[model samples]
Target: MKSLPRLILDIAEQLPEGEVLRSGRFLHLGSRSAVQRALARLVVEQKLFRVDRGFYVAAVDGRFGRRSPAPTRVVRSLANALGEMIVEHGAHSANKLGLSTQIPVRCIFLSTGRSRELHIGKKVVSIRHAPKWLMALGETGAGDAVRALESLGPLWAADAVPKLHERLPEGEWSALVRARGTYPSWIWNAIQAHMGG
Candidate 1:
């Protein structure tokens, strides 16, 4: 029983960096008491972070991600737990950028997944459902929430032209389009420049 803490820590270490430990999977190990005790000691030693009762995650600053689940994997896990598609946007973007801005106080994401607002961890996330033709304008990976934002290329004006009216009602879209929506350099400069960035 006492060795449970070390055992749990070892298991967590084996997970991809940034992954957190929680009840569901670990509870399958041994007696509930032993698992609980092991977790408690690990938390005390900073081997694990207890976000709340029965909820723990490995530190994100390091190389592991609880289980090294791909970025998509992580998002899927979060969505599964929330029982919805959780787009990593707004406040989630702030976290990813290491920005000092306040988290959106909501978890809003634009998607073809669904449309509505979601409440997760005291945050309300909004999901805007888009049509497949429109969604095809961009793709997502890694930090999907951010990727979605970046994918709005000005060259995709054909696709984006339809959305510009709604996404950038003001001149910001023109300017942002010119700038090319935070894309990698050398892809295409004119689209962004012509767009007005």
Candidate 2:
């Protein structure tokens, strides 16, 4: 029979790019220590990239040679694996929605999961834990609007609401309106005042 490390390498080679491999998944193949050592050996051999504690991903070979998967792909795969709700940061959302002219300098995401930094190759991506209400609409445009408003705060959001109402699709606008009940009083009041409630 093939050794555990060899078995792991075989498995990793067959996985899709950006697919996350949890250490727990290998428990059935060997003891915890054996699996840990096997994973570490693979990392040293440059066969796998360790993304976070207990998480690993196979390196992809492109024209530039071997490299970790794209940060966005890794993040998306990781979020799906963890069953966490992850969305663009409010600043990014604000910029995308034309509520702000400044662009975020770093790759930042808001998540229902704990705040953590993911280092995929040389690039570092930040994931911050956000309030549930901010993620209520998921990845939709209406959700972006809500996050943009939150990033802008009460004063600016109040001013931006009219534009949002005008710019957003009718369905997205209605979705935003319907979700106002979950927002804080300041945000809800701003929406109510500017949107004519």
Candidate 3:
């Protein structure tokens, strides 16, 4: 965040949703390449958008249009940007990962870290902390991997659990479980049992 220029800061602080950085030339001093470079770098760094041409926004700001991220990419990035208090727990990983059969206009999740509201790429993500006791039977992990588990759905244990277990440490399972909340009891139960508690 220290590398950010004051102008980039200014533009981001001003524009409406869906407006790109290049569109906000409040200070007409730099070359197109320079501005593009700044904007492009933010995008690549997940601070902005190399996601497309002539388009940019803060990665944590809600997204719109037809752009489709690799599932958990947006959520994970949001988690890192949001600080450590929020642990991706306000909603079920499956829904967040786009693996569930249903889609809430708002992106809801479960979090043992805190309770709050977030709008990610046009989808609203809500987080509410749960009791540490409830999490005893859940699993948590890196955002991309977590979304992968969600993408796998109820059949995920068969298709994804082994791979996920391989990627995560033995302790990560507890954080994820704590984040599961009260959705899809059957699926949650199966995952809890498969994980051995």
Candidate 4:
């Protein structure tokens, strides 16, 4: 059997620089202790950096020298690793939709799977549990509109009519209109009022 360090190095070579490595992935190669020790040694040697408990990413050399991967990439890898469905949070959606001027200090993602916090370098990323109605939006442009409208709240959802009409595809708009009962009464009312229903 190959030594744990050798096996780990072999695995690392196959992964892109920003990809996250969890100790659980190496169990097939060696005992858990051996896998963890090898990872710890790599961290000490500056070959890998621990992003969170049992989570590491290869240090990629750049113009300044070894640098950590971007937080967004790391988070995406984390979502894939955890087998979670993740989407942009309402605050981010609102900002993207031009409904808000302030940017969130911590990048937040809504997850239908698990809620947890991750640290990528100095940045903190939050995966918050989202309700089914919101998670139903998925990654569609309509999802962005839903999240943006949600963030704006019932009091302000009415203001999003013009923007929603401009950005939402005709089919998605029709879908939202047809499924108005699934959303908050105010949201349904706003759509209904605009559609002259």
Candidate 5:
């Protein structure tokens, strides 16, 4: 049988750049501790870049040596690996939907999985656990709009409602209406106003 290190390398090479590696994937090759050690050794050799405690990415050569994968990509990879529902936090959602002008210094996300922070190169991505009602919207534009409005609060509803009414697709408005009962009173009122209910 190929040694643990050799087997790990073989598997990594087949994966494209920015693909995340977790020790659990190679546990069959050795004990849990041994697999972790082998993965750590690979990182030490500069063959992999550890994005977080248990997440790693291929160290592909770039213009200035090897570059860590983009923060968004790493988080997406992490979400998939953990089979968790992850979505951009309200501030990011507001900014993306053109409802807010400010961009947060650090990118944040709401996740159904355990809360954690990841450093992807210079930028930081935060994944925080949120209420199931908030996450029920899933990772769609409408969901983002709902979270954004919730974060912006009731004060902004007068103006935000019209902007959202224009930006959100008809289907999203319907989805928002369907989920109205789950939202806070303020948000639900705004949704009501927007839908003319």
Candidate 6:
């Protein structure tokens, strides 16, 4: 019979690139401690990249030799594996919407999952817990507008409405209108004033 480490490696090789591997995935092959030791050994051998506590991903061998997957791709795969919603932070959304001139200094994201940090190579990505209303629109342009408005606050957000109305697609504008009830009174009032309601 193949050893636990060999069996774990065989399974890891079959996973799609950037797919997250957890200790539980290998538990069927051996005891928890044994599986953990096998995983650690694989990481040490450079066969796997440890993303965070209990999370590992196989390294891709490319023309440049070997390298880890892109941070965004890894995060997306992780979100899918954990069944969580992860979206770019409000600061990024605000900048993207031309509602703010300030650029975000860090790679921050808002997530429905618990807040945590993930280290991928030299970069550290932050995932912060956000309120459900803020995430209700998902990753659409309407969602981006919502997050941008929140980041800009009522005063500046009000000023941004005309520009948004001109540039935003009709469908996205309607989405914003539909979600108006979930926003604060001040924000809704600002949107209403600009929208002639």
Q: Report, for every candidate in turn, its global Cα lDDT versus the true structure.
A: 0.48, 0.88, 0.49, 0.78, 0.81, 0.85
| Candidates ranked, most accurate by lDDT first | 2, 6, 5, 4, 3, 1
**After superposition on all CA atoms, what RMSD does each candidate show versus the true structure?**
11.1, 2.2, 11.4, 2.6, 2.4, 2.3
lDDT of 6 at 81: 79
Better structure of 2 and 4 per TM-score: 2
- Cα lDDT tens digits, model 1, 86-122, are 4555345434443323555544555656675433222
lDDT string for model 3 (50-130, tens) is 322343445444456334233244444444444433444323554444444454455544544666654434454566665
Clashing residue pairs in candidate 5 (N, C-alpha, C atoms within 3 angstroms) = none
Worst ten in a row by lDDT for model 3: 65-74
Instruction: Give the winner by lDDT: 1 or 5.
Output: 5
Worst 10 residues of 1 by lDDT: 137-146
Give the CA lDDT, 0 to 100, for residue 141 in model 6. 91
The numbered model that scores best in lDDT is: 2
Residues 94-173 of candidate 5 have per-residue lDDT tens digits of 98889999997778889998888876655677889998878888997778988898778889976787898789899997
Order candidates by TM-score, high to low. 2, 5, 6, 4, 1, 3
Give one digit per residue, the lDDT tens place, for model 2 in 1-197. 99998898788879888888999989999999999999999888777888889999888989989988877788888999999988889898889888889999898999999999987777788999999899889999899998998999987978888888888999999998898787788877887898576
- Write one digit per residue (lDDT tens) for candidate 4, span 1-197: 77677778778768876788888988988788878899989877777777777888877779998776776777778778778778888888888777788797778888888688876655677888988878675777777777788888888887787678877789877776666656678877887777788
Evaluated at residue 195, the lDDT of candidate 3 is 73
* Candidate 2 runs further than 4 Å off: 1-3
- Report the Cα lDDT for residue 137, model 2: 92
TM-scores of the models, in the order given: 0.40, 0.86, 0.33, 0.84, 0.86, 0.85
Model 2's number of clashes is 0
Give me the displacement of residue 68 in model 3, in angstroms. Answer: 17
Q: Candidate 6 — worst ten consecutive residues by lDDT sum?
A: 66-75
